[model samples]
Target: MPSSISVGREARKANRRLSPRAMFLREFFRRPVMVGSIIPSSNRTIRRVLDRVDWGNVRMFVEYGPGVGTFCQAVLDRLGPDGQYVAIDTNPDFVAYLRDTVRDPRFSVVQGSAEDVESIVADHGHESADYVLSGLPFSTLPPGVGDRIVAATRRVLRQDGAFLVYQFNPNVRNFLTPHFDHIDYEIEWWNVPPAQIWWAWKD
Candidate 1:
């Protein structure tokens, strides 16, 4: 008989050792709310969660770890003319792809560090955003890096809005807890290996 294992577990393993291409596609799927790392092989579940949010009154949506622009496209499609989307990616390729591929006036693609999301958000003329979604790898970043990203998210997200993050590693929950009023998480058992999506919301 074959062993039956969860996809999340597989992703967790793959995450510990990701191929370059797998690393690339993982961005096709997720954004984390707390940390600042990208696992291109683990994003489908992240997208699934974002699709469930009620985006009606959301005028501005900011995405960290835009990666290859998977989440960026989703944000642009949902955010109407009245809605604006800004994506921050340190990868020049992803940032350039985002800028060239997505031409909507409501979309802005930036190449920058996830830790500086606050200034990025403010530079875009947003003091507080309706939503700040992230895909940064929180588990592997330096200690204060994850906290900084979360802090920036909190600084920008509106009182009634959300700060969503995805993590393959459960190691950073401590930092994630103090920054948000509510935190929600899920295990994606069907992805390449699988991953966890943690939504940190403050309202």
Candidate 2:
């Protein structure tokens, strides 16, 4: 049986009929740098990024800037029974919305910067993440923030874990190059504005 809190949340969600795209646009206008895009990531982009993951071995999957959870359900669908998905974002509205909407035992959303990913993962009872995905606009992040997030992500991932990233700006790869020995990437032209996708392995 569902708890009263969850039941209440569901009722509120039903009453709040705003679509995800509408909510995304509202947030983007408020914080374009943080939200990254006016619309949710294209389906082609999601598939291109997620399909690279070895879902069978993923125990903990961490995502940065999940903006309205465009990748949440897709990750959940492929996640193993015991796998956990932790999404970190600085946007309170997106965090609250995801908490209310994404009802799954394996899903957890945190309202915090990705720079604290190591401690965040620890607090959630995980030693290391098998994968960390980010769609953050590193090129526009406040000076030093992007570096901190990349360094922290490297430390939190297991040896063989991978960091998957998709961004409008390909310069984000420069952030990953120093930390990972091997990175494979390409452009997904099917997206509205097209997106640069990357899979950087910790090796």
Candidate 3:
């Protein structure tokens, strides 16, 4: 029988071999409502999301529904050595793939729901996050689930921190308005189905 160490190594290798698009497709097919999109986010959408962040002041960041980590690499690249990143995804496959692919000490991958952002962020030894990014499909989620996630996001972010969300529809803006002091919206048509980006901040 293979040793546990050998089994673990094989799992990691398998995860590494899975492409983001393939993983997205598999997960989407398995759970359309949970996976949200049929394909991984495009480079254009990733840029629009990351570009809105004030990287200079960001030290701790959290990502809700990281999926296959399309934005993970870019965020890691832009982070300083001391910067910390944590990603939460309810999909077990995505969580496993992220753990194997994003090999960075500063990164933490959690297999949990986005509504638990506060406790999850605390598990990583953070009191509050500088930025919280989400690729979650708010329009597809149940009203209660979406509200809880949005409320948790506001509670866990520092006063000066920002929340960046990208969705296929503009409905997310309505959900964010009550929690944030200010909100800004932009559209990226270069993406597959196009995307709407929202940058929200509190005083």
Q: List the residue pairs that clash in candidate 3.
A: none
lDDT of 3: 0.87
Sliding window of 10 residues with minimal summed lDDT for model 3:
8-17
**Model 1: residues >4 Å from true position, as ranges?**
1-47
Rank the candidate models, highest lDDT first. 2, 3, 1
The residue-by-residue lDDT of candidate 3 on 1-203, one tens digit each, is: 99988987787677678787887888899989887889888888888888867888878999989988899889999998889999999887788898878899989898889898898888888899999999888988986898889899999999878899988888887789878879888989988788888988866
TM value for model 2:
0.92
For each candidate in turn, give its C-alpha RMSD to the true structure in angstroms.
11.3, 4.3, 2.2
**For model 2, how does the per-residue alpha-carbon lDDT over 128-163 read when each residue is reduced to its tens digit?**
999999999999999999988999998999998889
Query: How many Å off is the CA of 133 in candidate 1?
Result: 1.2
- For candidate 2, give the lDDT of residue 179: 83
Candidate 1 structure quality by residue, lDDT tens digits, 56-120: 88887888876655576667667767887888877654564455556788888888887787788
* Residue 145 lDDT, candidate 2, scale 0-100: 92
TM-scores, one per candidate:
0.76, 0.92, 0.92
Better of 1 and 2 by TM-score: 2
